[model samples]
Target: MASKVGHPLRTLVAFFIVIAALYGLMAITKNWTPRLGLDLSGGTTITLTARNTTGKGGVSATSLEQARTIIQQRVDGLGVGESQVTTSGGNQIIVSAPNVQRDELIQQVGQTAELRFRAVYQQESTTPTSQPGNSATAGTGNAQGGSTPSAKASAGTGSASAGATASSTAKGNGRPGPALPTEPPAPPSPRPTAPGKGTPENKAVEWQPSQQDITDFASFTCPRDTQYYPDVSDQPLFTCNEAGTQKYLLGPTIIEGTHVTDANASIGQSGLGWQVNLSFDSTGSKQFEDATRALSQKQSPENAFAIVLDGTAVSVASVDQAIAGGSAMISGGGINQQSAQQLANVLKYGSLPLAFEISSVDTVSATLGGEQLQAGLIAGAVGLALVILFCFAYYRGLGVVVVASLTVAFATTYAMVVLLGASVGFALSLAGIAGAIVAIGITADSFVIYFARIRDEVGEGRGIRTAVETGWRRARQTILVADAVSLLSALILFILAIGSVKGFAFTLGLTTLIDIVVVFFFTKPLVTLLSRTKFYGNGHKFSGLDATHLGVTALPGGRRRAGTATRAATQTGGEA
Candidate 1:
């Protein structure tokens, strides 16, 4: 197991190996690349139209735009990046996501988007450090917290679980993380209400939490996989941080997002990087000021308020002081230009006045798909070239081995992708291509690990042949462990992940296994064969395996960090 893994002459023409290589080479180039998904290739477009219910009035411009925003959010929930949703004419909203999950996405965009103001009552988290102002107590005092039953409701023919619709387009692809809740505010009592009903004075009543709310909060878990927009402003709301780190118990609707008349993302005047500025209408301003003031006075979790949308908490921060101006700014937590814009957009689109009905769903022609396919290929090619060039520039003679091994791995992987696509309906989406690109880094890292190990052996004064064997022994275990971890992660993501990201996980897992095979069967033996050459055995200065450049100095205990390894030639090639 130790020495044999690296042997060059272990077997000549292993029948199946040769046959598979020949067949793969012959079949892989059939189309050269795997099938592209809609984002990379043109796919279908869906058009949904908003129509007001009998008493709700006609679909006004404002209502149409709001419906578009909600529809966009639903299509975006899957995070395919290839999707596009826009409102055309007065009542038409269009969505262009890949046809792979088109039906599912269509149903998602048709639901309603509600805005809510829930007070942080009691919060709990298993994370080690409790955030300032967080309470883990259940139903203690007025602390309140609960979870969204679903992120969306079925608007049309088929209704998927709210979990299915609420899948986050954000990172983590919906993985679990823990978060602590903040300060205690008395749970608002349930008060019968009318939405947007009365003057600001009438909105002053706090809605209370029921026993069901307590049970819901207690059972609430970290990293909620699904979410639903709060349809009723008077109800206790339950939600988790996107990072899954913390949970919040929030009070009633103190301030509706409609209070925010305008929002913009920009760099802070105080040089605090990016921040979001919100301007409010008079009523909105007064209400926001009161809410912020209340939050500012509370303990940590209670001190912080969540800006939630469609069953998700987009942002949460503790108030530092009373924000009385009605206008406010949000900053902190590594918010950058892009993230700030995202925050602003979410806030801007969070509350839409209308819902939409799917008008028609249609497939886009494959005519323009090549552009995305080309882009994916272009990125992969560039990344591949850079890695290969770096190996040669740094490794010198050893660059030959690195390049060869990488080529084998690449060829094998591409062949498998194509073969799988042809036989098992494994279509390659943009995310899949990204996974392959990431694999390039993993592949390069494997070479780096092995080369470093070989250099270590040479540094100890071993001949090239001996170093190769010893290095293989030490490095093989590490490579196996790393590949095992990679495969495990891929398996989990492929199993648990939804939407295109799951395909990304599949590609990742597939390529990882290929790394193991190419490294063991191709990399090890190729290096062994090359070690027999004059340039390498003699430790030519340009050879990356040269002991001196590697800083191998022979130590007093027969140890050497770097040296001329003149005795390297005396060792038999397969001595190990």
Candidate 2:
């Protein structure tokens, strides 16, 4: 016989051997965990409609996109992992934060995120002109405007009143003047203060703002309109107000989070724990350099900028010098591996031009999700069992191949799903399970096609070896074409549909791809090898495609035998 391009026995053996090895590795890796979705995990999902509160709700794609960007920044500030942020209805934003504490998440998510950093002017507390690592000025002047984290005391007529003190202070060897005592009665204590009254010490510090804070041209009713700019490089230590209070006044952001191109958490250079590494685009790099240069000229606290996420400060570091490059590293105390990873995720995903506001908030109890999951599993089990039963009743000894192939398919699918969930934030929903159930039919059809093809070749008077080759030659094309159609449908659905339908489409697409792989690699090869066996090769009656049962007529003049089984050719000559 002339050799065929694809050997059936070789194909079958190679497929099963590879699948067996993959399944074994998956099992060894414990790739059996079922992933829980947001509903199952019991978290908060919020929807917000983006409307210009200042304007008369004039909605635009730009506004929607801006809102999404802001919302992502806000959500990231919350440090929630695998959170879903997307837009819908052109005006609404959807946020799904799974495994998050609902009420707290709601509170954090509900607020329109605002980023601000104000300069330090005068504080109500003790003012240090020069701290240990850095130094600054303690002028007797004041800016009678909004307090900033890094505001200098303006020298005015008040300088005359402190002339005597100034001379004495200047003569004291250019050292930082001591902070005035809280109480009086210590005559000539060198620390200048009004007699019998305590004066608030004033310190100069500039506020560095983030890009969000700067871009946000929001107006609010406040006693002071202090402008804030943040040191984009270094994290701030203690932002002080002009009133001598430890209040961080932020400036307009020179760089925004949008400038970041990529972010990831990894082991710190010191081998301590996790730290987030960030890289920004050209614009962000230039802005960062300028901001850092400005801060380098300021005091310690003012020389630092705070990375404010949501409403809380995640980090503060001092900018020793200007950072000319786009890359930066954030390192601090006890940033856990999980938190670092979350930060990286937020930064990485934040760059995508995706934003959403919650239009609805629903909390399905874990019990409900559990029930649904249980039902889905039971349904899958029932379907598998039914398929098994049908194979046994129809195929006899060949039923074992059907069962084994199905098991391998299941193992491969489950392992892939679990790993995808872990690696890509893929959550298996009800629709996904249904897709898997539907896959049962597809896998079964593959077996039926192969078996029927073998029988057709055998009925044509070909020996088992030739039948296996001819059958595969015919069956493989049909399987590929059928699967191609299914895969195309899945791709279309996944691309065009939304919500749960997309979930269905995704699973369908994934399974369709897997089906093609298994049939081509494992099933056909294994079946080809099996046809070489004595039981199968000798046309055992128990083999579902046995020629005797099928009433296969080898020749036109062949005599008919009574009580022989009969089967019709598949009408379409292809698998379902």
lDDT string for model 1 (1-576, tens) is 345533464632352385387466646556556655665555678777777642366789887876676656645534444355667888888877663455455435553434344444545443323332211111111101111122111112132111121212211112332332334534334433334542232243343345545545545555542332233454455666544455555555566677776666777655756766677779876676566555555443455455554444545544444556556655544567755655555555555565556678887766555666677789889988988888888998888877776776777777777666555446677778888888888877888888888887776556677777789999999999998999999999977876578779999998898888777777777777777777876677787766555665532123332234434423422122
**How many Å off is the CA of 86 in candidate 2?**
7.1
- The C-alpha local distance difference test score for the whole of candidate 2 amounts to 0.54
Which lDDT values do the candidates have, in the order given?
Answer: 0.58, 0.54
- Model 2 segments beyond 4 Å from truth? 1-31, 38-42, 47-94, 97-262, 297-302, 309-313, 347-362, 366-386, 549-551, 554-576
Deviating ranges (above 4 Å) for candidate 1 = 1-7, 10-33, 45-358, 365-376, 553-576
Scored by TM-score, the top model is: 2
TM-score of each: 0.43, 0.65
Please write out the lDDT profile of model 2 over residues 388-425, one tens digit for every residue: 99998888778887887777788778877776765555
Residue 378 local lDDT, model 2: 94
